[model samples]
Target: MSQRSEAGSDAKPGNRLTVVIAQLDFLVGDIPGNARDILEAARSAERVHGADVVVFPELCLTGYPPEDLLLRPSLDLRIQEALDQLMAAELDAAIVIGLPLREKGLLYNGAAVIDKGRITARYFKQFPPNYQVFDEKRYFAEGTEPCVVDIRGVPVGLTVCEDIWSDGPIESAVAAGAKLILNLNASPYDIGKQARRKALLERKAQANGISIVYANLVGGQDELIFDGGSLVVDQYGQVAMEAPQFSEGLYAVDFTHERHCQPVSQPLPEEPSLPHNIYSALVLGVRDYVNKNGFKSVVLGLSGGIDSALTLAIAVDALGADRVRAVMMPFRYTADMSREDASTQAKTMGVQYEVYSIEPMYDAFMQTLAEPFAGTEPDTTEENLQARIRGVILMALSNKFGAMVLTTGNKSEMAVGYSTLYGDMAGGFDALKDVPKTLVFELARYRNEISPVIPDRVISRPPSAELAPGQEDKDSLPDYAVLDQILNLYVERDYSAEAIIAEGYERADVERVTRLVDVNEYKRRQAPLGIRITERGFGKDRRYPITNGWKIGK
Candidate 1:
């Protein structure tokens, strides 16, 4: 493939600058499909939106975190073939698509600038983020030089996700005489991250004295949920256009680039509130995980608990109630209110549901264990048996119906090993695996606001597993508020137990939570893949070995 430039001197300044931000969900390692999606998006931008330029998310061709697949020599050739196909398309608009590039014996996380059947320019990402869910340093060699290419009289500066998060890339772009900055991103979703992104973009635009168009990828890839909160900010630090978070769409914004002296008058679209934002993240995460992985429907055990209720609500909202099935697995110690809440929530969500009582199975297991445990007093062993039974039934239904089982355990439970492996953890996907228990309540309230689908009693009552008689979550663990705080420090912030204690945490509470987290590494290893709404999630971010001897205080 020959590279050519369409550089022209002193092109006329056009008043209407149309930029299309393609908020797409690209599958990992699906090069052909991803290329097709990009071409289709480009066609849509040119034919439908009349856009002069279209921008895609970072690494849209090979997906983000191709992991060790970058080691394969053939992957780069495949991406090049895809890029060639895209460049050969008949679309008139300039296309900026992310793909890996091999230049001078080093691989680069790069984006190609294609216009009118030719590759004009390429921008390599400078900051290859290595911390917290990113391992770019492991694959691609970082680029030091900034790229600012001229596209149809508009000087466009190109940068990837992490580049704009810092100062150097954006500053270099402005220094290189770029009028507009196009930032491609695959930023994963976390609580309050959307707001932080907007704030940073606003600052970047104001500081650089250029309009910035931020495009982020949307979907769940294993654990990572990339919330597509793409937006355009003017030089005066004002938002011109904002795209919806956690949904896929082609959004266009017209920027008047003729010597901007006054503030841009484009109406700023309203962004979703915090609770709604979190809810949408969960919904998109569940929806993408189910649909992308070829699952027709989802099956989850409805325990009349808050975690399951929230997970069910998210699943139904994402895949619709018709595709979501809830099963009530009642046991010996299960309360009537628990059953009633589960049934009511399922009915309110309009999902298909069935009652599967586990009393008989519980009795059989107990009878079998009676001979071996006759002398010992029954503790959590009996309680865990009921949970395991419920897990078995859910998995059985999943196998029978070809549906994916959605585990409802929250991050707090998963973090502290409060959940049972081969029981509640026996599912293909976990909907709320990254969401802490405190945020779970906030999401429940948010769900009720849209339509009071989840029963108020489910949200109001204290969360309980009901594995044993009169059991509550607090009986085994600390309050969710305190627990989440400690977890945020330990997991997200990477604070030590002594550091957490120094930051006003009770020594005993910190010790207990840290110990649980350390001892439960084996269980987390067996947990299902879920949407990553946090900086540190179980599958990728937290990778502690099960047989480690490193104690917290030691």
Candidate 2:
């Protein structure tokens, strides 16, 4: 439900400010459309909610992380046209919206305050974060000035994303006589990003004796998913207004400065469980990737393993039963239990299910290569053939039906080069790309709690590729619990082999796993793009050369 606290609801006999938190989903590179949305929302906030000011997210004009689109020759024209649209809108409520402001030679990440059909004030982003999933320094120069504008007799400060992440912007705003700071954010979500943001904002508010209004972008843009958990922290570090995560809408809060900064609002909702939050991120990432990319449906090879089962469930939840298709390909080594579980889960989820046997295809390939393999013993070539056969079939269907194929490889398998390239890794997108194997089981159980869609056996049984007879993941891999820890430290934390070994891990296991990760760069490079749920994912966060000679030191 939308919470609203109109001006004077609990304020003294003085003018109160109604600020609208426009937590909205915007498409990247849609300059004109974003401006239209801004103007439209501003109009409603003024007409319906009696809002004195409406605050939008960071980079709402060109969308967050416009990337190289900001370099387009026509970018200036588009942004100027958008500003003109807002001026033409004649919105009564002053709107604070984010956009790119190009000066003489350098471009800046900026926000503009529009009121009375004119841009009154502007604030540039002082910190252009260049770390993981952020390369703002590549495109934008750092801003140095603080902008504090008067919004109906209230001194309000403005800062873009990453500005408040540092200390200077907020402190400057306060020093410039800002009683409240409006920080625009396009901050993407990871596992525990919300908690860190709340803590940081609370401390900033409490220490500086200033109220903070944070508005974050919502929706998925490529691998990143922005959870729309917009919030307002009062001067005393009290959370006066809290918005729900993963949903987009306009939220309102009434701030009165008669005596001191005080915001009145209803009780906020609690944060979701960890698994629940991860599940929602994947779902939003999948939904937006499919819808935004113009895919009608998605298809995936639903092996009975937990990874594929979890991927299938996520696809169903993201795009719905009608938009998801599951294909079970049986080989000679494919167990009866595997086929049964795959079928049962698809039936429970109400997705279109099909079965195809790759024995004939495998036999034909083997027969063609019989002469060359006359003296050689059976090896990974045969095992990879089975996986490649399935890939060919899925790709054939995708080509014929226009359904995008979703790969089901998880982070654990991708990290160790355990998957076959162009085989299981062949797909347009991966739902579990950043998820580890152990977390895959946790999410499967979490989904069942919502409603039993995945089979219990699928979650309880041992994971296998079902390539050779009696094959299980542990046959060639360390235990998932141990391997995931090593992978996390090495891949996400960038810990060296010696550093990981010092963490009480077996030295041999650490060396072996780190070597696999290093050698598997080629595989990960060719893999499909997936949802990013962790602080470091293979897609945008971690970048390594296909050929390198760096070694870990003791």
Candidate 3:
């Protein structure tokens, strides 16, 4: 790696600049720690890589989406302290970092360029996105100007996360005589988002005829996962260099000012399959949420279903098999095949496994409620009772051993309120809360391809809660193949029932599924927060009044 320090000197020669992209992770609201990390990375960039400039991701100091933390009275004071610490270091390389800047009683999502121990330039984010998972408009006053600075005798422009999404920011920088653009991002991942980002940057770079360097943050924060696929796009819009997604490192791109700023090309990293990307996102999300929240390990109820089987594989991958525990709570309705598959996978994965029948607990609960349900026939109450008993058992183990319980419900079930309130929904984290049923099967197959950890029967068998005799998911809901398409249209695309029907889905299926989603807001509201992978998840991504009287039709 020391050879990299001489990269600039060996390049085309006249006035070469090496800018290192600091694709790193920082915990939200940890101002002091984040500042320390920034200084450490900058020092390494200068000492090891001989970098002329080190650019960090957006909001690296306070971390991205600080949310209501930005509203605290002491935010400005803490930010100032962090900046003072950075400026005092006086490192040799110019460092570009992000934070919330308070000026004249207004807060801005801003970036500061520090050169040789002093503040040289600052740029506030011009566009503060408010849709989907972003709420920047609630806290920031958008900057009205562009910032271009000189580094190593080359003109460089600065832009924050949302600025490049629109046309104005990059164009303004080009008009301001910037030969190269540096974009600091805390961009989250969705399906095929990386391709979209590269295409967008390619068009922007070609249209402006200016090279662009993108530095993105990596890691998981609550429900959000920022995949750092930092790269350099040349003036002609060709991807010159790229760092792999879901990784953290300092990637250097060399540039020489011959006629125009030209980035030295490097071999591009191979793009992973979509299943691989989604699987990696889930692993990172679960690991960070569990570890960041200070849990030692995780426990989940494995009911021999695809949802739990996939979740078990993910947990083991994220935290290792030693840190994961699987419990099987079987009732009278549970099949021998279901029990056999659960045990086989648990043993194969080498995780701690246990079985405790819910018959006694269910009997106890039913007897206690016999008088209250005097004349009521056996219905969902009995089934729900079985689920709640299993939930209580899992929660007890979690409480006793200090392991967080992982809920195993997928997005498809979450959409229609198929999950019990305190039953299967009782847990600290859910790994599949954003994954639909169809995608769940795809991931299960993908995981098996890597290594056969999950039992084949688990994937081949029909999914059931085993709360009632001979019951399956299809007994109450439509086929997953049709249901997931309806969900994607209605939940993600915001299509109305009529609009979904126009997409060729049956009107009865559309109306029933849409109504279930509408009325089940209360259930989802109480469910545990999970990793978000789709464009619209049931977390901060979607908000609706649970008591609204709005109709289902357009």
Tell me each candidate's TM-score: 0.94, 0.96, 0.97
Please give the lDDT score for candidate 3.
Answer: 0.90
* Clashes (N, CA, C under 3 Å) per candidate: 0, 0, 0
lDDT of 3 by residue, 82-126 (tens): 999999997888898988887788889988888867777888888
Please give, for residues 1-554, the per-residue lDDT of candidate 1 as tens digits: 21224562343255566788999999998999999999999888888888888999999999876888888879868987887888778778889988888889999999888887888889889889887788899988988877887776777889999999877988887787778889999998887787898899888888878888999998888788898879888897788777888788999887676775222345655767888877887888788888989999999999888999999988988998899999998877788998999999988889999998898998888888888998999888888888899899988899999999999998999999998889999999988888899989999998888889888899999888888778888888888899999999998888999999999989999999999999888889888988888778887787788987787964
Deviation in Å, model 2, residue 80 alpha carbon: 0.8
Alpha carbon deviation, residue 23, candidate 1 (Å): 1.6
* Candidate 2 C-alpha lDDT tens digits along 1-554: 11111121232247688889999999899887888888888877877788888999999999987999988999999999889988888677889999999767889999888877888887778899999999999899888888888777777889987987788888888887778899999999999999998998899899898899999999999889999899999988888888988888889988878756567766989778999999999999999999989999999999888888999989998989999999999999998988999999999999999999999999999999999999999989999999999999999999999999999999999999999988999999998999999999899999999999888998998888999999998988899999999999998888888899899999988988888988999999999999998999997899888887888544
Superior by TM-score: candidate 1 or candidate 2: 2
Provide the clash count, candidate 3: 0
**lDDT, candidates in the order shown:** 0.86, 0.89, 0.90
**What's the lDDT of the predicted structure labeled candidate 2?**
0.89
True-structure Cα RMSD, model 3: 3.9
In terms of lDDT, model 1 sits at 0.86
